[model samples]
Target chain A: MTKGTLYLIPVPLAEGAEHVSYTPFQLELIDHIKEYIVENEKTARKFLKAAGLKTPQQELRIHDYGKHVRDKVNYQELLAGALRGEDIGLMSEAGCPGVADPGAEVVFEAHKRGIKVVPLIGPSSILLALMASGFSGQNFSFIGYLPIDKGARSKKIKDLEQESQREKRTQLFIETPFRNNQLLSELLKSCKPQTRLCIACNLTAPDEYIRTQTIEKWRSETVDLHKKPCIFLLYAG
Target chain B: MTKGTLYLIPVPLAEGAEHVSYTPFQLELIDHIKEYIVENEKTARKFLKAAGLKTPQQELRIHDYGKHVRDKVNYQELLAGALRGEDIGLMSEAGCPGVADPGAEVVFEAHKRGIKVVPLIGPSSILLALMASGFSGQNFSFIGYLPIDKGARSKKIKDLEQESQREKRTQLFIETPFRNNQLLSELLKSCKPQTRLCIACNLTAPDEYIRTQTIEKWRSETVDLHKKPCIFLLYAG
Candidate 1:
């Protein structure tokens, strides 16, 4: 009979400005919360410092969230406290905590222990990029990042393009900060002329660019795509 | 040169409760925004009244959102103002507004008009479902919903499943509330035996369920998948 409540907090999407994804309305109730579990100790300290967040406000460093694949020990301890009626906030480095970040294991553990998991939307590049990309929203797929191998990566693009066409499902993917331009070149070379492509770069930041264009146009265009880290969405019509 | 910003506001995930995907950090600023936006109308009046949201504060016209959406003329006028740099909050009936929701149009239109589209994090069923599916979150897809036609929908599922398997990508989809069970049955019948399927129903709700099993297990077992809108994830591996 344990009911622990875990709040999955979404962090800022870009460097300076915050991304719109995690907007947990109840988060203003910082006083209601007594414990916070974060991916990194320093970040937890920094976030507390940055925002001046506090409950009883005592800092509790249980252990690294990475201590175990499941981190059952620390997880159970947190859940135990939560079951005794404690408010807990779980955080990761950036983006949404449980998506591509490190809160999945904690979320699962919390669930197994019958804890109520509440997600707060603040910032997520994936959903924002998908929305900004004029691709088909009716159906779409997000493959976090492309493979590193050039040949395999190109094959992946071909496969994704094919899937989008056959299924009428929009295909979305991301690349490393360094490999963005290279990925664009490959997309232009490999994707068909009619395919719809969108590049959402520096999302939420001052220099944000959500450029939606056809592969043909993108192939011939000269755009400052290198402005910042970006999300790539491709649709095969 | 208005420099209008786009706010991707998240509405509730369920009827009475607030959405979990929304982070509290962002909601703090929204409180400040209400003062500016509601020069004429109080935010508590406009936002809560429009969304039909009820609180200890006042009698909620939950049906107001329906009425608001139905009043096409009035709604478009609101859109006009938002497009003109009023910094309107893009909200939905529930969940993240822009992803698969009709509000995405404004985001796209905003980008076209050179306005800044800012996405704040909050409760999104899509990312939450993906995190719980136990599938590889690193590379996954969000295909919003399936078609109503049986033939076309079946074909779409087959194609997506094939791609998921071939590319080792996770295919995610959501269903209308009433059609959830039907969709689950169809998924069991259509997806291959080895394909790993996950069902996240009533996410963040009291009766929420996150079940992962093979197609065969899903088909052979008795599942009480009813009443709630659900997200389906089928992984290639």
Candidate 2:
């Protein structure tokens, strides 16, 4: 039998239950899959229900293989069904799967084993933030999360800012929900006044806020990004 | 009047008439948007018609601001409708707008003018290819297109591969449609035998082909990617 295809499905960025975030094509694809390897079973089930999956919860087989489930799980077992000609879906807690998440390892192993992988269109905070940031889309780097330590984190920011200036590229990074404001403050303090900064908060939520301005302009504004998922982009050139 | 929102819309990747590439939500948005800034007015019209846009052909306002029209047209006038509380949609010839396309300029100018930009969930070939490549998802750089000169192109490829090795990052780049085969041949001839390369061809189309293998294994395969839009990803680490 041919190896089963793996689908990299995307989830909504917001947590609201009423959010209709997926495309019809994506929803159609979700309804057809019976197996899923998700970051959180509860949220995955909720997302599936929202997508209007045809299969009942009792018939669906879901395996937890997210960041929380790492270390205890042998990933091979996750793809075992796929190897036996059963299509499997991979879902992240939010946004596109295998992107700044633990699903990359799964995708890596699937590629190594030569299984078919398909990615469905959905909201990606990173890409959406960058798209609205008005930065260099032609050349950019996603640096994921920065170091947490004060000194190390500050140094990394400086390095990334310098790289952005030198290469004329957009540098993207995310922060913990609570640390969003802290990172913004640090960015304003460390980067040059003329360096452009874009803060995209609650990307797809009803209260979405996406604004791009210079560090100087950001410093003057009264901003409160506490406990919100935010993407910070900087481009000096 | 309040400033209108800017929507970044996605177009079908192939020219096939039978392809239903958009989601229902996308179709709804397209139907409501009367103003569009597109890469190709003809193709954009065709796409809108297929997506069930309700606006008649004569009433739909499409202003072409692609690379070819860069110096020929003033873009600010295109968004005048949006600035007067009218929503404007931006569409590309294929794939998502403002991504690897000239729509970024319009998006950038919108940011400068403090306009709201909303990116609808749609197909993005770059993210799709990366998700399937099984390479480094946490740290990656998209270097749009390689230099056209033979020597510069080869050198750029080597530099990108070296950077990929040093950073454990996935390096992504594209080539002109006609140069697709030439770039693949160069990649096969230049990269190390163990380096991993994935070519995502005819993305989102029925003939979609996504395969990843070591340089050694790819050498044995016959590849003819002529006149096809393809994304090439390589990871040496």
Candidate 3:
């Protein structure tokens, strides 16, 4: 039997938003996969069920490897089934895997073993936010999450601003849901007043809000994003 | 009537590969959109027809842009239908719009007019290639296209390598289809032997090939990518 391919699956950015966020083709593809490496099995099972997976959840072989799964895992073991001609999928809890998520290791392994890797189209908050922000689409960088410490985070934001100015590159980063407001406050205080900031909140959801404004304008407005997942993008150029 | 939203639509990377590259939702969305701001009206109609558009090609209101169609388009005029409760879709000739495409102008205008912008998930050769590359996803930059001049291009490659080494960021860029092999040859000769490069060719198609190797390893191989669209990624970290 030929070695099976590994599929990089993209999931919805938020719960209950799949209908609008995912294409029917993505859903159909999700249903056919028998083995999956996901950020969370519980969340993955829910997504698969919503996507119309026919197999019983108990019967499906799932390897969870995100924050919750603490046990040391052999990355090669996850792809063992694929090597034996059983196609497998790598999924993240939200958005596309291997993108600010944990599916990269599996994809890296697939490359090493010469196994074909197919990336399916689905909701990716980063790309979606960038598409909507109207920022510099030609040159941009995704810096993942920001530093947790206050001083470091502030310094990093300034550095990113400097880089954006120098390279004319848009800088993108995310913050924890609850710290959404704090990050915004930090950005408003740290970045230059003229630096443009795009706040994409609860993307692809009913409450989706994406706005790009100068830091000065954002500072003047009374805003409250208590616990919504948000992506912050700043451009000094 | 409520103001219609702006949809950032994704198109196939290449011709005749829509079935596998686009999701059913994307196709359905295309069928429903009456007005489209595309890279080219001719190509947009062809794509719509292939995606099962029910409207007659002549009846579809398409405003062509890109390298041709010299009239300076009034972006607000293109979106006037959306203000009148008619949903408008911004589409590129290939891949996701607003990214290395001409769709960002409309998205920027949408924000100014307070019109909702909905980004539908679909194939993005850049993201797909990065997902498959196993590079530093934590920090990565998309530089779009490099300089065409020999000296400038070489200098830019060196600068990118230096940035990648210092920041541990993955650098991504694309080339004109016919110049794929030329870019590869230049990269092999200009970049350090140990610098890793991943060439993603004909992404999301039957002949898709994504391979990563040291610059030295690629130097000895025979490659011919005559006119295939490709994404090139490199990292020194």
Candidate 4:
């Protein structure tokens, strides 16, 4: 018997962001998937409802892969339904699954078991930030997050800046919402004066803000990034 | 007077792949724009028509940014409509604009001119490939095309493989459709037997193919990728 396919679904980056949209194909596919492996059960259920799932919430079978239970969950058990020829959906808290999220682990296991993996189209903050940054999209790197240590973070900033300059590649990274301001300040202090920096905050939201300017120019501006989801990109070339 | 917003739009990767879908918000926005800067006028018009454009095709103004005329076109002139307070869209031959395409130049100029740039949600082959590859997506680099010269290409492959192993980061790149097989063969020859490789071809299409296997396992299988659009990912970690 053939195993069921694993569908990778993406959720909105911001809650209540009405502008966040999904393709009809994605919605139709979601309607047929009653089983899921998700980062957070509550949010996933809410999203499924918003996406027009006809299946009743009580009837849905959800396997929690949330951070708190990540270590304890049996990934193979999550796919047991799929092995029995029942299609399963995999979702993250936000954005595309398996990109910069723990969802990749589930996807990795699916591939090992020879299960078909399908990634549906959806909003991705990383891709949107890179597109609007006006940086070199041809060659770019998403380094996830910087070291929390001040000294190490500063060194990483300089190293990424140097690499961007040497290779003409764009470097992208993010920080926890509350620490965004701290990261922004460190970036201004660690990067060269002429290196370009782009701060894309609240993407796809009603009050989205995206701007790219040189570090020297950014130093003169007064902006607060406290407690707002944001993606930072650097391009020295 | 405020400058008009520049919308970065995405087109389907394969022609007549009707399974490809877009957002309602995207369709609504496309209805309001009558001017576009596109890689190919023919395909752009076809996509717009299929996307439910209410305006007649003859009334729209298109700026040709196709490869044949890329060097001659004045990018500023393409944004003339936006500068004049009329929204304009930027599109590539396929996938997301400003990503691995000449659309970035236009987006860069938009930033310099303080034009608002918004990237709409849509299909992106690179992002989808990474999601389905089951490789490390927390950190990854898209190196674009490799050196076409045989020796340089092999050396670069080795270098990327080393970097992937060291950083536990996925490395993604593409080649002209015709050169895909050549690149695949080279990757198999240059990488270690344990390195993981993913071939994502004709993504989002009916016959979409995505598979990840170690170099040793791949050598035992027979597959053809002669002229198919494909993204190759390597992860030694």
The candidate that achieves the highest TM-score relative to the unseen native structure: 4
Question: Per-residue lDDT for A109-184 in model 2, tens only?
Answer: 8888878988777778878887788788888899888999999999999999999988888999898888888888
Lowest lDDT block of 10, candidate 4 chain A? A14-23
TM-score of each: 0.74, 0.94, 0.93, 0.97
Clashing pairs in 2: none
Task: List model 3 lDDT by residue over A1-237, tens digit each.
Answer: 699989888887877776666655566666677899888888888888877788888878998777755357787788898999988998888888878877666777787787888887777888999988988888999998889999999999999999999988889999878989999999999999999999999887888899987899898998788788889999898
Worst lDDT 10-window in candidate 3 chain A: A18-27
Off by over 4 Å in 4: none
Q: Tell me, what's the RMSD of every candidate? A: 6.1, 2.0, 2.2, 1.4
Which stretches in model 2 have alpha-carbon errors above 4 Å?
A16-20, B16-21
Q: Could you tell me the TM-score of chain A in candidate 4?
A: 0.96
Full-model lDDT for every candidate: 0.66, 0.84, 0.84, 0.89
Q: Pick the candidate with the highest DockQ.
A: 4
Docking class of 1: acceptable
Clashing pairs in 3: none
* DockQ per candidate: 0.32, 0.63, 0.62, 0.75
lDDT of 3 by residue, B1-237 (tens): 799988988888766666556655576777788898888878888788888898778777887766665357786788898998888898987888888777776787788787889887777888888888878777889999899889999999999999899988889999988888889898998999998898888887779898877899899899888798889999898
| The candidate that achieves the highest lDDT relative to the unseen native structure | 4
Q: Model 1: residues >4 Å from true position, as ranges?
A: A15-37, A56-58, A66-89, A109-116, A219-227, B1-8, B18-92, B103-110, B113-115, B146-168, B185-198, B203-225
Indicate whether candidate 1 or candidate 4 has the larger TM-score: 4
Best-first order by DockQ: 4, 2, 3, 1
